[model samples]
Target: MLSTRRRQFVNMLIFLLLILFILYSSILARFRTPEVALDSSSGSFLTKTYLGLENEQAQSELISGSSLHNEGQFVSGNPQSSLSSLSSSSNEPETINKVSTAGVPSDDVNNRNHISAEISSERSVLKSEKKNEVEEELHRILSISPVVIFSKTRCPFSVRAKNILLKKYSIDPAPHIVELDQHPLGSSLQKSLAALTGRSSVPNVFISGQSIGGCDEVIDLDQKNILATKIYELGKQSIKVQLRQTT
Candidate 1:
């Protein structure tokens, strides 16, 4: 009987130990962290550098600045200009495109360039005096009228803009129309207009020598019923200026 009791106790202890071992293994598995092996060459998970974004230089500067800030050092002044600069830089391509397009007149303009602006002596300039004469002639032309339309006769947009201004609304001191396509210095003038107005297209309408933009802009103003009001208000201001000058 004593021998039987010893065997039974040994068996109970072994069973208990086996149960404990199983429980410990299961608990360990539930709490265990799996190791992940990242393969950079495979282009899978973990080490793609572009994940930081394409603006790596910007990011590095930001990180470096943050570190400097943490260290209580002078980082940078007016970082706000960074965004403004980026915006302006992004618009550079459009400005270049405008200059290029204005430098070369349209197909119709190439042939009609001998038609002349008011048939004035300023039609042609000597190469030696070209730049100064161009500026001076443009200034003279702008002062001829309170409202001016730099137009290309064959351009549909130009025609539309003229129709809107001439027929739809009655403007005082009648707009001076410079058929740019007919002018000798047309391309130069167009390019200058691009520089001045940020628009390379014809039908560049000006009030008091300020460009209001091309056809689409005119249409937008018309749609809003502000075109007449704008013209009248600008004309009124021009009159006031003249009166002030006379006084």
Candidate 2:
């Protein structure tokens, strides 16, 4: 009584329903089987074991033998046992504890050595800097003439020395009178002069490329009539004349 197309559509719907019923029955049958679940559990266990072995190999390659022991204990969920094993494998527990305590002294010694080395390196650098400064100062001092007197304005000894040089020899020690107290480079100049002369006294006197000592020393040399003679002799031995002739 139905047309051909309608008959075909009805048949197709029946086939689909039958297929779905078969799939539902198969699912129920699978759930009912305890053996199927056991098989799945076994497969999962095998996969986990295979992956665990690969991970173990990778870990072993990364960590050292002693460290591997700790890793294994951790992976096995027995940290207490791992630490106990590490301690027990060594000497007696008290001796092991003593050795651990003794490590502090060695660490202290190492730190001290490092500090000492740093101090030594700093000292070496300071020495080099001081040497360079001294050399530069010496070069500057020798290059000039006409009595370069490095003195402090506030110093009585410096004032006395300047008066004596001006009054006695008719020599105006100006234009070269480096008044240290008034100048910004006062402290540094004083320190350098002291270092060079090997004397901590003030009023460092230089006349014709020669160190004429402090105020008292200069006065004594002048009184003894040796100052003028020394100055004249130094003038003849002029560094400027020598350099000019060489050029």
Candidate 3:
């Protein structure tokens, strides 16, 4: 009976040892390296996905950078076009000045030339009228007598010259004494005489509308005794002309 009891005890101890061994194996299998292998595979998949995403982002950044560069080129073209327009605008006035100088006369310049021509013509007309008036006056003075004397009232030389021609010679159709200082158109007549006969002094003596010069010349001619003979001959000629006109 004791031997059977010992065998039974041994069998019970072996069965208990087998149950503990089975329990330990099941616990170890529940937390094993297979799970670690699955985690490793999943981590590898995640790393590949991350790498792909980074590559795509880099490509997008490159594309965006290229687009920005193209946009910058487009933006820069606007300033060039504006500069071209400014250059064209600045050249417009220069072209206009060139055109004006070439042969297309400016209106203002033409107007100025026309005005200058008109002024010159007007001056010419006025000068011609003045000359005609002066000539008419000269003819009237000469027709007064054959012998004419231009004299000044205040000049002693003119008085002496008149005395020599009138009192000493006793000339017929006696010299017409003109007092220039007392006359209204005296200065004008003197200037005209200077222009016509080259004589402008007092006692400018004339015989038959011819200048004989001033006081000293007349006295000299009288002292030489030729003045009385010249006067008598001119007087006879004047009387003959008057008689012929009367007939």
Q: lDDT (CA) for every model shown?
A: 0.74, 0.67, 0.74
The digit string of per-residue lDDT tens for model 3 on 1-247 reads 5699899999999999999999998997786445344455566767666666776787776565445343233222345765776677668654323335546656656677899999999999998887778778778888898888999988999999987776656556766888889877787888889987788788898777778788998888778877766654755566221111122
Best by TM-score: 3
TM-score of 2: 0.44
Ranking by lDDT: 1, 3, 2
lDDT of 2 by residue, 1-247 (tens): 9999999999999999999999998998776434444455566767666666776776775464335343344222356865776677665544322323456555566678899999999999998887677667656754665577778888899899877665555443332677878756466667777776776667887766567788998789778877666655655634221111222
Give TM per candidate.
Answer: 0.45, 0.44, 0.50
Where model 3 places Cα greater than 4 Å from the true spot, the runs are 1-113, 239-247
| TM-score of model number 3 | 0.50
How well is each residue in 1-247 modelled by candidate 1, as lDDT tens digits? 5698899999999999999999998997776323211333465444344443434667777776555455344444347755675567668644322323456545435445645543444644455378777787789889999898999989999999988887777666788999998999888888888888899889899988888888998899999988877776877654322111122
Clashing pairs in 1: none
Lowest lDDT 10-residue stretch of candidate 1: 238-247
**Order of all candidates by TM-score, from best down to worst?**
3, 1, 2
Question: What's the CA RMSD for each of the models?
Answer: 25.9, 16.3, 23.2
Off by over 4 Å in 2: 1-112, 167-175, 180-198, 221-226, 237-247
